[model samples]
Target: MAARTVKRRHVSSRLSCKLFIVFTVSIFCVVVLVTAVRRNVPLDFLWGAFFQNGDVSNFSIYVHSTPGFVLDESTTRSHFFYGRQLTNSIQVLWGESSMIQAERLLLSAALEDPANQRFVLLSDSCVPLYNFSYVYNYIMVSPRSFVDSFLDAKEGRYNPRMSPKIPREKWRKGSQWVTLVRNHAEVIVDDEVIFSVFKRYCKRRPPIDIRKGKLNLKLQKQHNCIPDEHYVQTLLALHGLEGELERRTVTYTLWNQSATKTDNKGWHPITFSYANAGPRKIKEIKDISHVYYETEYRTEWCHSNSTSVPCFLFARKFSRGAAMRLLSDGVIDHFELSALLGNE
Candidate 1:
């Protein structure tokens, strides 16, 4: 009876050990499953979050008139006049819509002027640093206007987003603010294949899958999906406008180390000083001189220009104090605004 009891105890002990092993394995599996589910849950949540707010159906444009101020009345008048001129130009090219609607309007204008010689697009901030005759002469003498850089045909990789019918070589890229020749403008507005692709893919979110799982560094850089940078470059390169571009733009901008933001909010006003010449100020004058001398009144790649126009047609984020310095006849004279305006 004792031997039989010992045998029973041994069997029970073996069974308990096996049961414990099984329980441990089961617990391990559960933990792994839970971790995997938790990881996947965030991706789903992220997708849902982006999708719900990602529909851009209600996006609209807003246009605000510059507020009246007591600075130089002539400068103020020029600013307003330039604004109205831009508004009128858009009106002639396309019908009314919100500020967001301006892109489509521009497309319409492009379509109406396919041969690329009708209008020039300028921003309110751009002041002519050259006289009207110089500008007109430069445009007339140039082999191609600013639009050519944006809309010429050149060899490049094919964009799947664009229609297969349109070859991958006839694209162009440049600043949104440009002097458009009538024919090229028509081509842009009339380009059903390319424009459809652009409109579909050129919004806040690109339809391409290239950026998946990469921490969206591209989005952070430009702060939007299907940023204008990618849109113009890809489209123009695909459409064959690569070689026609003069590789220069007349605008100027300063994005150097000295322009770095001091605040956590990343806002820095433009500062002009007679005693302290910053990078932007120095670069602006240097670029102006280079263009005036080298290109004979033409500038190419004004803004860092690799992605878009290198510099801006006008620099913003200026303090009210800076504006006074900019408006002064002495400073303005030194910068040759008087020569550029000719009649102001």
Candidate 2:
């Protein structure tokens, strides 16, 4: 009887192990390319490197371009993006509700693939901090999605007019670039109530000069609200999915502190030039282990599967010249090689 029991236990363990492997292999990540133009030059090679040693089936790509633009070989260098543009894409404007519309469209398209267990939103300028395997393992092992959500106290960007449909208490702010799980992505796609309120009330306040000629005095007083910045964060909060998010963005961005809202220059994230896209700058971003949100007084320590990990998986706002430098420097390729050796 004891011998029979031992044999049965061993058989069950082997079966469980095989099932786990199958589950892991079946799961894949969807990279949502949310950009107006074709994919950046370096990203083509960098992403190619990602799948060089792995199965292409383990991941998928979807691009959300403007209405007329297509992501074929004429516009992009890689064959991966050929014919990836969404047929239903609309014209996208900065700081407008249209930006969020593009995101929703991309999510809706990616969700069609049931095998996509994770969804990561990336821009044309965004670059991977680690190799594909590291990023895959980091995102796949986590139980929750990565979203940079925090209280909107400062800036007073939250419009009071949106209250009732979107209460001030539930109004949150964060980076538009986020990595969501399948459930959260579905929530974003299915949402109609909060998104309608945002389109109606939440809009970017026109610049002082532009408002003088194009707007009435009433439009001048409207609160400045960047829809993409607040839409995902607020929508998730409204759904009471706060516990299911990491509350921090994996795509790091450096804002130009000198450019204030009052200045005609306007506020924008700093774009990396070829001079600043060297090894040291990349290392600095990689070294970030925690992020402190001043408004909420919360510090988010990065982790994957309970083990401490770097805060950012990707960094954005790189110019085409800077991106080319990254490829020429072998910076990304080195990481891919190191990641492969580490696994062995």
Candidate 3:
């Protein structure tokens, strides 16, 4: 009787130990599965949760066409005029909607064509420094992951003019002017959550009516939300696709010139001359080559010693009177025009 009792107790203890091990293994498996699913999910689904019914692949390139209270019909016409000249191999997304709306448009376009290779977003002032063939070949031959590096939060963060509702880990920064891959573009356009968060919290101040002496104190307090930096950065970071960007844009600009002028002022004519080089003049081919080689040319002039320099893919504010001079100066070739226009 004593031996039988001992064997029964041993069996019961062994059964209990087996059950405990099985429970622990099951919980671990569940945790790993959940993490994998979350990481694999598309950003569009997460952000565009509010609007679930749009085709995303119809368009390939996105152009952000907001002429914020400046420039004339000629400038606007120039963009379209030049844009239309490009071959139709690439689909161009153009609209004057708010940043959020523009993103939505991009999302709709992406859904319509998942296989689309490249997306270039441009402003009205932007011109194709190179011909369409060069641009097209650049898009087709470059690695699909070139745009990913720019989208990563680890790369850079946008200035939060207003507090964001989404967590900071999900934020990123890139140029308003960009060339993106189709998948990455879709992620940005389809993001519903990030856009809503920005729209609600990022307030854009209305233009203040300034009278001669009396300041309108009430207008000063109004929060104006400008979507240029924060809008694109936040959405890209959250999607984990930032690593795919090239960390550079192809547009060029001269920001230093634009800064000296007043806001809402008409475009000023900028001439690139050896005389105009200021204190830091590029005197020889070496100097010119050094500046061009060291600097990364995107939509703006960046990586220069002067803060007054304008950083853009295209510089505006040129006096209309100087337009003819600009066209004739042949300065465009100095801007690496040959490289961009290569074989196109």
On TM-score, the candidate that comes out on top is 2
Candidate order by decreasing TM-score: 2, 3, 1
lDDT of 2 by residue, 160-276 (tens): 888888888888888887888889989999999888998998888876665367565666677878898899999999999999889888888877667554675555789999899
lDDT of 3 by residue, 101-155 (tens): 5444543433454344455544322332222323344444444422211222322
In candidate 2, which residue ranges exceed 4 Å CA deviation? 1-28, 33-43, 210-218, 334-344
Worst 10 residues of 2 by lDDT: 1-10
lDDT of 1 by residue, 109-163 (tens): 2333222232343332223333232333344334443432332223122244555
Of the pair 2 and 3, which is ahead by lDDT? 2
Estimated TM-score for each candidate? 0.43, 0.84, 0.46
Model 1: lDDT of residue 22: 4
Clashes by residue pair, model 2: none
Q: By lDDT, highest first, what's the ranking?
A: 2, 3, 1
Query: lDDT score of model 3?
Result: 0.32
Candidate 1, residue 6: lDDT: 8
